[model samples]
Target: MKIKKKKRTSLLYQTNVEYGDWCLNHIENCAHGCKYPCYAMMMAKRFGRIKSYDEWINPILVENSLEILDKEIPKYKDKINFVHLCFTTDPFMYKYPEVVELTLKIIKKLNENDIKITALTKGVLPEILKNFSPENEYGVTLVSLTEHFKTNYEPYAAPFEERLKSLKHLHEAGFRTWVSIEPYPTPNIDPENKIDALLDIVSFADKIVFGRMNYNPEINNFKDARRFFEECSQKVIKFCEQNNKEHHIKFGTRYFDNKNTQTLFNKK
Candidate 1:
């Protein structure tokens, strides 16, 4: 797809699965090339009928997106409570620094206009957090602390320890930090203990979002997935509540039921 600026359909769009106030995609493709099935992957499978992730995730720059965003912001100035950066692609992807720079420039413009911006990614760079204002939220995506699991699933992205370090750095820098435990994998051993350690690093974050693994027919043995997700959610939510930290449960058709999911989504 060609990269150019254009008016987005909605200045404020609902997050499909993950937790956040609203979402925006500053770029067209993601760089991480995550091994697990993601929203983008699912879409690619639906339309292109493409089997492999590599064939679909050719990261492209959306040059026109920023200009379109600049014009679109004013239209929903009153209703847009928070703006999420790049829902489909990781803004901090190694291949799109220039595009990410432009994206951040637009975010700064929105901030100047009194709009709040939040971002979620697995490829966060420390320098990016330095430029973010207090109103900007920074969320890091995590699933397991085991080096092997991270290497196998999120290979192209930063290491697990590096991500934790980045989260701590962002928190210390005073940016509102959050953690995303989505696409939780089913492992031979229970990872609840590992999650506690990961949460310890993110304890300073303002909030945490927990989402279950997406159900892709190609992936098998998903029977235990929902149970594990609920367990993880209960553990994290309880921990957050005990520690006086904010947390939310994200739901989708593949995992938790819609009615039960709303309990957290309805919150402010």
Candidate 2:
């Protein structure tokens, strides 16, 4: 619940995560405290940005983020396909009004320049987001639907139903919407329901991004890990096709049994 501010050199930069998209992490740490070996927290430590998990759970807002964007947006506005709100931190982090204020400003700034924006969050999507350009895309990270799984893994994120409801509202409002089921847990961690059951809930999404968990040793112990993910990935593809939706199976989620690696996104 502690807030701190720090300065950064630039607010926007191209990320190579999937297909070279511009991204910005306006905050240093996340308050969600996700325990699925949070990759952001891990990277923060590896880079000596934070000393411990406790520190990582306390977010540090990027100082003058708006001013930096005001200057940087013009330089890259011509080349940017769309600026992703955040990959390392939540823009609408719960119980943090300042974070939300900054996020609104950033969205407005980019929209004023006719730049597109894409945002993914575990926190509640503010109702005002509907005021933004309809071209902007919004998404939520929803790997599980059970509160038991949420309590154990995502300690501080908004409840699963709340996130879904929020996203559904956005979708209903004619805003482009998506869901990221990235780092989805194997049965050992979730053991609740099949992937289809979960996907059924977010079927309204315009797109779905699915990926298997990584950087976790426990997953490696699951002997059926490879098979489980392959079957799950296939299910996602099938569901997306049947429902006439766009979906992306992240790199490495499916082991190409035929060793033919195609691009991740398959629009139906």
Superposed Cα deviation of residue 236, candidate 2 (Å): 0.6
True-structure RMSD, every candidate: 4.0, 2.6
Worst lDDT window (10 residues) for model 1? 259-268
Candidate 2 residue pairs in backbone clash: none
CA deviation > 4 Å runs, candidate 2 = 257-268
Q: For candidate 2, lDDT tens digit of each residue in 72-164?
A: 987888888778878888898977888888898999998889887888999999999999988888899999987778888899999988899
Candidate 1 has an lDDT of 0.67
Worst 10 residues of 2 by lDDT: 259-268
| Model 2 root mean square deviation, Cα atoms | 2.6
Kindly list the per-residue Cα lDDT of model 1 for residues 1-268, writing each as its tens digit: 2334433443446664444566777665566778776777677678874566775566656556656666777777777667777677786764456765766777777788887777777875556657756767777888777767666567777776676677778788887778887766665432433667767767777777766666544325655666666676778888999999878777551344444433322322
**Backbone clashes per model, in order?**
3, 0
Error of 1 at 65 (Å): 2.2
Using alpha carbons, what is the TM-score of model 2?
0.94
Q: Rate the local accuracy (lDDT) of all candidates.
A: 0.67, 0.86
